[model samples]
Target: MFWEPLRARFTREALTRSFVALRIRDYRRWSIAQLLSGAGAAASQIAIAWLVIELGGDGIALGAVTACMMLPTLLLGPFIGILVDRHTRRAVLLVTAVAQMLIAGVLAALTFGGALELWMLMALSLAHGVAFAADNPARQLLVMDIVGRERMTSAVSMNEVIINGARVIGPAIAGVLLVVSDAGWCFVVNVLMFVPSIFVLLSLRPVAPAGRTEPADSTAAAARPIGAWRFAMHTPAIRATLLLAVCASACYNIAVVVPLIVADVFHADGGTYGALAVAFGLGALPGAFFSATGPTMPRSAEVRAMAVAMAAAVLLSAGAPTLPLLFVGLAAVGMVVMWFIARANAFVMLSTPTAIRGRVMGIWAMALPGSTVVTGLLIGGLADLTDPRIAYGAVGLVTALVVTLSWRGLRSAR
Candidate 1:
């Protein structure tokens, strides 16, 4: 009787459109695997940062380690994207998964054997970065291949939800593990987590690239290194979207800046910092779901509005007088920022042709980590010279200025 009611409630006509993408079998499998992989990745991030601290490394050391991790995305993203387009995406994903598994295992062994050093960690981070440079584009293109364009927006939004959920859960798990055991165990958990994803990828049927029926000769001709760049440069909508992404990336430096505020300004510990991160992730859940379920709006207006909202939230966070207020501000920031990201991603995907999607996404991918390197350096230097709060305020100001200046172009493009 209970099952009957639940089944009726979930009938085709009764279910929300936001979940329509999950009705596809391959996408469901991919999503589950992505969840596992995302959670492990998130947990590994916490473990890596905590490990650096435990090793008596200071802020500079942490920054260096992070830079090592992101540098490959900046350096190799274009080439990786081209490679993804030229080859089978599933093979790329499998290879990257195996490579990451091996890297994580090595890190775990080194840590357990007491042979892990800062330089070794940096080297491992660089290797992981190289793997991710390929993995990111392949994974994105694979989503489009499985679900097709109609459900692409929903799938992307759900993917963000999974990623944010993992961000919340992973750190908490890492924190607990660190309390009971150590960072090495966290790495071991990460290595084990990759197992399910690898198996899932192996089981999935090959999905041919959508709308891509070009002859081998044509594909080869278009696979030149500068092809993707030329396309992005000449395309107004793509160019505008990427520029907006660049601004969003700079604004996202708040991720690094907020931890500093929690520790230095709020006089809090690691647990408190984790709580704040969880709050942000929790806020992102509803934001992502709303974007997935809600009616489609004008992309330019949505982008501009969300950017303004994020700016206001950042300012509020920077000026927050109490921890409670800060939490509220951070939650608002997370919500709007995620909404912005979902819209921006959909806009880019919808604007680009399927033939060059991987290369375009690669460029988009580059904007994210590339901007991280830029904003990281900028925020770190400014914070050292003045206050973290001031650094955040400056970022917000720049974000607002960039969004406002681009308003007309984005609107006309829409």
Candidate 2:
């Protein structure tokens, strides 16, 4: 599901077809762990953003902290991608899980002791992002390890379901913790979330990627150092999808604006922040479920089309003057953006080989959380200068223009 991502066309039957990925036993077990970890991550993100606001920090501080969490992937993702391809994905994942737990512990400790500062938070976040870069590709390519290629389309959609579902639960939990306890408790939850996944990974055995009859080691031997980069750059469908992702990354970065909008525009509190985030996750769930029926790899044209639709969703979200309307708008954004991302990710995963997927998907990773390194600050700064509505409107227009102007390069996927 790495190469081509989807058609905007959808129907009622898609709801039933989306369950196709659940038939595999290993994938079900793997998804359970993914759901928990994703929830904890989502919860922690809101917790951190609220903590920044509480700590005498401004929008720039929010942007810097967010940027720090993503900066490592922009800087080291490609190299780390190659590294995971050369080794056992399980080991890389295990190490990353442990590293994140330790970092979360320290963060929790600092906050609980009343000694947590903005700089300390940023430092820990940068460390977390470093672990995140290593964690992402290894974990993703491991889907190939658990489920074969034929199911990759539904599996990717199911993965979105897990992520967005976590988004729904995580923020709700964070909202409660922020009201009753402290942000430190959110970090404590993060420390605990990885425990089941570590056990699951330790219990699992490895499988070879699709199209590979050889043992896993032989596959690793053929995954050359620069192969993923060269393959993605040269491949037209993959190239177009990823390029669109650069703009998609910037446009979809609404985290910075959500808090600002809730506070400044809506005059809301922590509960409202979590409610809006939940709305986003909830809205995406149906689309994520519906997307499970498509071809494993999407045509490049459809990917471009989805980008335009997502831009419209963002602009509408920006213009929502009332909170209820904002919920409707953000939910719409989440629904459309989920499809956009699902298409982009499936393109990269399905079009490429199992052997080199780790490295290639690393480059894909560079486009999102990696792109956030710049977009995070830009969004934060834009909101600081104007307002959330301006920040959202500007990025929305830019995404529409970028996707609309460059329509010719990708040859129709053969």
Candidate 3:
């Protein structure tokens, strides 16, 4: 009798806690679109990196390409955020999806024709980045709009789970495609994958900005672009989160650093590189799910602690003497990183007023990837000059120190 009641309670709790966002119809549709788009993007990442290497690009060249992909976010994030707040989010998403599809198609055609050049790839990366600036803020705000603050944390965590799960599957698929054919096929597949996102986006109901249910002229003052920047600057929690995000971006330049490690340190092939990527994704899956299921800790301290833990994990990966140790370190890093990102995103979403959420998220979008442009160059140059391991260690140590010193301030923000 005791065991039966206990099991019944546990089952009831599990059912209640699982995937809270899926209960909402629009969020479900949006999530499906995100999954397909995320997977396509992940696969394209592998294809793009491999293409650059095939075209005689080195570490710096690869870094330049990565930087180009992120530069537009840094440059155009504020403006795009303003637009996102002013326009219907679903419309913004539809336009971005279509733009991305067209860009991928052009890239695929060029690759197939054997006429693709490095400059052409960089130019396309810029265009892709521009599309992302609009897409990132709109999609993030749309989740908030659909689910509201009560379930925002679970919704964001679930979204991360989908994206990271796709990260695992996408590269594995790309690895297989690379074995049979070439990078162009991966781009071709990406083009087709975008179709679902376009369709789903079309079906979603239009989302109005917060406070925009009133007359447009009356709300225009509140919707001004400068207001978003001012709010983020004055808001303690948002300000600290953005700072931490930039620091995290520097430490997170593992995308560039890991490939170098696989090639130079481990002397591994493409398959091993894909396996490393999968390891990170696999670790992130549980972390995201855990966050989705229930609360962990106070968002502020939670983010700070995770940042420090992630730094330690990166150092462990940097100092790993063997492949097994390296993989273990990476998995740890992935878990902590995902938890940190989920918490930080939720914290920002919950803390901000819904009226300027788009602009706020746009700032967030800018800070996260914008830092990568600088760190990419730093990590890439360091890898080129000395060793990738040293670069990783330096970045991690610096991140840990910065977060440690700022912990009190971050805690107070809550």
Query: Where does candidate 1 stray beyond 4 Å?
Result: 1-15, 56-60, 208-237, 253-255, 296-298, 353-357
Candidate 2 lDDT over 1-414, as tens digits, reads 434332333545554456666888878988998888888888888888888887887768888998999998988866775567556888888899999989989988999999999999999999999999888878877886777666666677788889889999888888888878888998899888888899889888954332332466556544553788888888877777787787777765666778888877878887788888889889888767655666545767657767888889889989987899999998988887887888777777778887677567778888876988888788888889988789888878888876766565455455
Number of the top lDDT candidate: 2
Off by over 4 Å in 2: 1-18, 206-237, 349-358, 410-414
Give the local distance difference test score of model 3: 0.78
Give the per-residue lDDT of model 1 (tens digit) for 1-414: 535533553455434656778999988988888877777777777777767655765445656676777788988876665567667788999999999989989988998999999899889998998898888878877887888878776677778888878777776777677666767877887888888888888887876543443576666744654787898888766777687677677665444566567667887755566567667777777767656654444366666778888788788888988999988887887788887888787777667777676667778877876657566667766766788789888877877887777776677765
Ranking by TM-score: 2, 3, 1
Residue 286 lDDT (model 3): 72
lDDT of 3 at 68: 89
- Full candidate order by lDDT, most accurate first: 2, 3, 1
lDDT string for model 3 (155-244, tens) is 766888998898888777777777678778878878888888888777777878754434656567545557988998887667878888
lDDT against the true structure, each candidate: 0.74, 0.79, 0.78
Better of 1 and 2 by TM-score: 2
Q: Which of candidates 1 and 3 reaches a greater lDDT? A: 3
Task: Give per-model CA RMSD.
Answer: 5.5, 4.5, 4.3
Candidate 3: where is the Cα deviation over 4 Å? 1-18, 145-150, 207-238, 353-358
Clashing pairs in 1: none
